[model samples]
Target: MAHPQPRTETSSDAALIRAWQAGDEQAAAELVARHARPLARFLAGAGAPDADVDDLVQETFIRAFRGVDRFRGHCQFRTWLLTIGGNVLKDFGRRAARRKVMPLDESVRDVTGDPHEHAEASEVEALLAAGLKQLPRLQREVFLLRAQQGLEYAEIAAALATTPGAARVHYHHAVRRLKEIVE
Candidate 1:
């Protein structure tokens, strides 16, 4: 018996979008699988709570699917998805502000270690989360996109609707501030 050949990943997001629009449910799944974890990490690093990350991710995908027809290939799909995730974060922040609730803690992970190491890591994570909260909105977005999501300045700028230079500045300032706090 002959073995079936494995499918290759699509070279471009436009192809995936076309597949999705053509009613291939697997295409949507592929897109989500490609982008979801990074988006969740971006949200968590931007001060969203661990409990709310999954809901926010679901909402992001729903919004993306609803508006996929509007997506032109001007930017990469990751950039576009980050833009959607940013908007969701902003909306949540606005609502939280209106309700007079504190924004969620930005730290969600506890890296495994010995007891002393665990304690030290926890303290550092808490401090880092506090420092992240102190950053301006744009700085936080830029920093998280670059640091957590590993997006380049161009991608960060596209996601945040800013110039690459501006994104670089925001990221620099964020790194400086975080270093001051962490070190």
Candidate 2:
């Protein structure tokens, strides 16, 4: 009878990639588990509808796994995964544009006329969501990736297939516009 080799633990994502390439299914599962939540957060924060996020996230992993052999390890796995997420978002956006479905206005109403309370907060959130929708796609993506996902500019650049400098510029413009809308 043949015995399976024990899996080695390592901090390097490259190690995980090697293990995965060697047909260790656990390595693939670990990679997906590690990146899944952050990817979902990125999709949600980037304005994907609540109902579609899970589907999009699943699609991202499906695409990633299908192309796992082509992942050359030129970038960190997180960066690469986020790049895949961005591409998924782009595809979603294209489909949304074609469908021409306008997202519902998210204004939350309060029955009570309390001047300083939950209603104000809900109103602000609604306004912020609306303002975010007004931003150009690149700017909205950069802002959400940085602010919501806590991605550094370099990672944002990689995800967007742009330079870090451009990512910084987009973030700056997005912040400025959002501030104007809120204030």
Candidate 3:
């Protein structure tokens, strides 16, 4: 008799995806656990109110699983996930706009060691957030994917469904505008 190998956390996302497709529910949960925080960060950077980030993240994963068959392996799974998340946020934004409810800027202020330093950092973050809101959708997405998530231009291109060159151009324009806004 042979013993079955235990599942390892080191499993690649592709393997997890395959297992999920095979109806292994644990695989889906694992994927969510692995990607949730990063996905939340991306959603929040894309202008999701802090309160809505969790719901948006859950919705993104739900949509991704529902449409898993449409995902080609052309990009990393995280990149694909982020793209779905962006769409989810956009849809939420539209609904929120229709309701005429303005989202509050409620980013948590770090109450840590140095009060003055924390205040300075929060001010910079606020300025950057304001600048991001002013950018066009594609430019904001490209900038957040690059500057916030550290995704390469090619991955960002795949996520945004644009050419890498176009992604780079958008990122450049975003950076230039942000400098003018934040500085």
Candidate 1 error regions (>4 Å): 1-7, 98-115
Candidate 2: the clashing residue pairs are none
Ranking of all predicted structures according to TM-score, beginning with the best and ending with the worst: 3, 1, 2
- Tens-digit lDDT track for model 1 on 31-140? 88888998898877777878789999989988998899988766788778877888898898889889898744434444455867777777887788789989998898
* Local distance difference test values of all predictions, in order: 0.81, 0.78, 0.88
lDDT of 2 by residue, 21-93 (tens): 7887888888877888988877766667766888998899888877878787655677677668878988998
Sort by lDDT, best first: what order?
3, 1, 2
Better of 1 and 3 by TM-score: 3
What lDDT is obtained when candidate 3 is compared to the true structure? 0.88
Question: Cα lDDT for residue 13, model 2?
Answer: 71
Error of 2 at 78 (Å): 2.0
Judge candidate 2 at residue 117 and give its lDDT: 72
RMSD of each: 4.4, 4.4, 2.4
- List clashing residue pairs in candidate 1: none
Which 10 consecutive positions of candidate 2 have the poorest summed lDDT?
103-112
Give lDDT tens digits, candidate 3, residues 31-100.
Answer: 9999999999988878898878889999999999988888888889998999899899999999999999
